[model samples]
Target: MRGARRVPRRRVIQRLVAGMTVGVLTTAIVFAAMGWFPFSALRPREVQVAETARIAALPTTIGFHDPDSYFMNDADVNQTFDKMLATGVKNVRLMMPWAGAEPVQNQFDWTNIDRTVNAAAARNMAVVGIINASPQWAVAPGVPAISGRPASPAQYADFCAKVAARYKGKVSAYEVWNEPNGAQFFAPQPDAPGYTELLKAAYPKIKAADPNTTVIGGVVGSVTDWGTWLVNPVSFVQQMYDSGAKNFMDALSFHPYHYTLKFSDGMAVANSPLDQTVALRRIMIANGDASKKIWATEYGEPMTATDEAGQAAYIADLLTKWQEMPYTGPIMIHTTRDRQTGSTDPENVFGVYRTDWTAKPAQVVMKDAIAAGIPKSPEFQRFSAITDPSYGEVLTPVYRATPTVWAQARTVSTLFETPTGIIASPTAVADKARQFGGIPKTPFQNGYQDFDLPSGMRIWWSPATGAHAVGGGFVQAWVPQLGMALTDEVRDGWSTKVTFEHGYITWMPWVGFQVTMT
Candidate 1:
């Protein structure tokens, strides 16, 4: 059942890896690197919102995860790109299979990939190349050799670096290993730290190769948690963040396959795959990374037992639902063409086009949906203090449409309830009354905000550091200092540091906080 573009049913696949268990944590790397700098303060004596903060919007676009361009003839590939252009597609996710690219150690064959990248680039389509499929030499002894990860993170990192360097301006983004949460793609068992290692090692090299290209992490598996071999998107993402994944990757990628359910079916009803993103959003928010985007790299419905029109309706509904999720980036439809026609298996038919290259009802639905444009979710204003206020400063400047909305919406919906616990704020500020564990004792002054927690700790925020709790040992350490926290605790490579108006505190992994004065 595991052919070119199809994945087996979750129920059936889980039984295959039945007694398997995921390694909860990977070994934390302690680098003996040497680099430090003096605190050049960002908190001005008199702060202004315009000078200190900015907000930009992320617009949604539709694309495809098709293999025609990679395996088809040159003329056929050009035709495929032309069809995509005609369908109003703006993005494409192509595979840069590591096994096929580098069969021998340090040796490479860029034939199919170069063709795919060049074709997409020629048509002005954005390409997100997924770097996966480990080769024989790269896989360690006894690891499930097929689609297994390289034994060392450096090997995968090197391959990713080469792809970035080769496709410099062509590839818009790179998805680091597809569905590592599933044993099918990751092999043996899923490991969060192992995946994080690949990201940590590849991220810097990818950035060094092409700073403009986005490095997407967390290409999680199916919607719900069925077994240890296939971790749920939410749990896997949480584990990734725990393993220091936040510092790496430009955006988080996911495959929210909703099976037979309609996107309109609420989370409680469908066990909604799209709503699953809200949980991932919460993880990002709690980790001080609400600003980043979550990409739906693969999603679609199969036309096996269902009516073609019903499949089209499913796609149409998905498009409408995704527009309300502001945190979502581009959505790549599973495949452009069907793997087989008249096949009883649902896995072989997740395509908008038939095997004969004829357009299906879903294709027309997709074209119309893209033409209509996507809107910002209504809840976009809720997390403005943590996400919106610093948008332009943190990420690259992308053109957002009118009305100035923030990227994500669902995470802080509950936190923004009123004093009476009723109306939510139309304007964005830090979380409302009860969220800081206490009521805000200060007014919103020119993009700065704070609240006193019940634990006697204070929550401070800045455009540079979002929102962070300054309490306990850090507060005890700060009580003897000259001024309040000017910035939140931040991690740079190996060490964690926070700056005050007069001095700062730095903490290493094993070593606790070290206080330093200006």
Candidate 2:
């Protein structure tokens, strides 16, 4: 007896039985929750399809920066034109320098111009010839020399009429001026009066020559405080409207360049172009032009040599978001080729293609993005999972679990049971949960437990608490230790029989409950 050791056989048996009970109960509970159990009397109803508005076809136009320069060498111009055609580009915005086209009074040279048109047409790309800048003949003889400001309204109108008549049928659209709000282009005086006069004179001639062609005005440069230059885009638009010039144009064009005062410094904030575009849209809506569409005539992301990838991602996201908006129409990236000067702007790195005719990584990404359609962001994906239940098989309640609480969180996962014999944190349980569909609410805490009930059914613990859970259903949870957060959650129908350890808080308005039967 002294040599024999005593053993707790009953305790060992009890522990084994408890472990077996948890295993069996978990399987039964999962089956019950999934409506697979024979005793399951309730089933989740099918999720409703969300209403999505049909998006209009977005215009794909590439800015042909300094066409005058590109066409300088016939061989180079022909090669570039052929390449553009091969790229599947359907449209080009060609900058037609008023000074260059009409260098001498009433003396017009259409040699290079005809070459450009014929070349583009051969590739089947529609041309949007932008007439900008003033020659010495059109302006005051002794007026200060500037870049794009036209000299006289009458001369500018005459030049526009000639351009319209020459390319009436071939050109798709005509933009009257470029960055008229900027001192660099519309300088001497950046006032809207001069611009309105130019539009009034040019729009009629364009329409008269070719009724099929579209004439657009207001190629206002960036969203700067135009007031500083004695011109506000909103006010300028109003002036144009008041001047009866609004009806003359088919679309309103704007550059919307998010130019940083940093002068190509690497530290400038990105998304400036998008922000300016939104502001322009708001201005248009505020001014009673809701029906009119906006054309981003010259939008771009100027990236530093090292930040090309970031630039590509930014461009992709911007274009995708732009396509989603209702009023947005036609966005033309600034340039097809890098500036010859290797500068960050005008001669800077905004070109999608390198000077050597190689496609920049950004260019490749852009082409891929356009061909692949809008990219789905992670935020959008999570939102969709919460709002679209039929999109996947996982229960919404199980999909929304916090990743820190659940180690099984994957791109997709299904929840089946609660851990009792095997202790799992709340975050671990939530990481395996599916998110509920529809608009997202606040976050809450959830707990899991199990109970053996009558009818061979088991009651599984499913409880939620927190800011999101306060409104009901699955709530997002945050675990600071893991530096992880649960974006969404769903309370599966199986949880109906199980009592919550902690009651959920209701912060949102009460929506009627949906019951399902299988």
Give residue 281's error in model 2 in angstroms: 2.5
- Please give the distance, in angstroms, between residue 216's alpha carbon in candidate 2 and its true position after superposition: 1.0
Per-candidate total of colliding backbone pairs: 0, 34
lDDT (tens digit, per residue) of candidate 1 on 1-518: 11122243432112223332222111000000100001232121221111111111133578888744555668878877777877888688887877555554554556667767777766777788888876656777766433567798998898889888777777778889888888777877788889999999999999999898888999885545546666777888898999999999888987777656665443323224644666677688789887788887888888864789988887776676665555677788877877686788776687788889799999998888778775333443333344444222222111111123222223222222334332222122333222333334444444334444544555554545455556445665664453546665577999878787678988787888788999
Taking the tens digit of each residue's C-alpha lDDT, what string does model 2 give over 204-319?
88788878777888876554353445344555666666767666677787655442221121111222344344445655655667677777666665654336666566555455
Say which candidate scores most in lDDT. Answer: 1
RMSD score of candidate 1 (Å): 17.6
Backbone clash total, candidate 1: 0
- In model 1, which regions exceed 4 Å deviation? 1-59, 269-271, 374-518
The 0-to-1 C-alpha lDDT of every candidate, in the order given, reads 0.63, 0.49
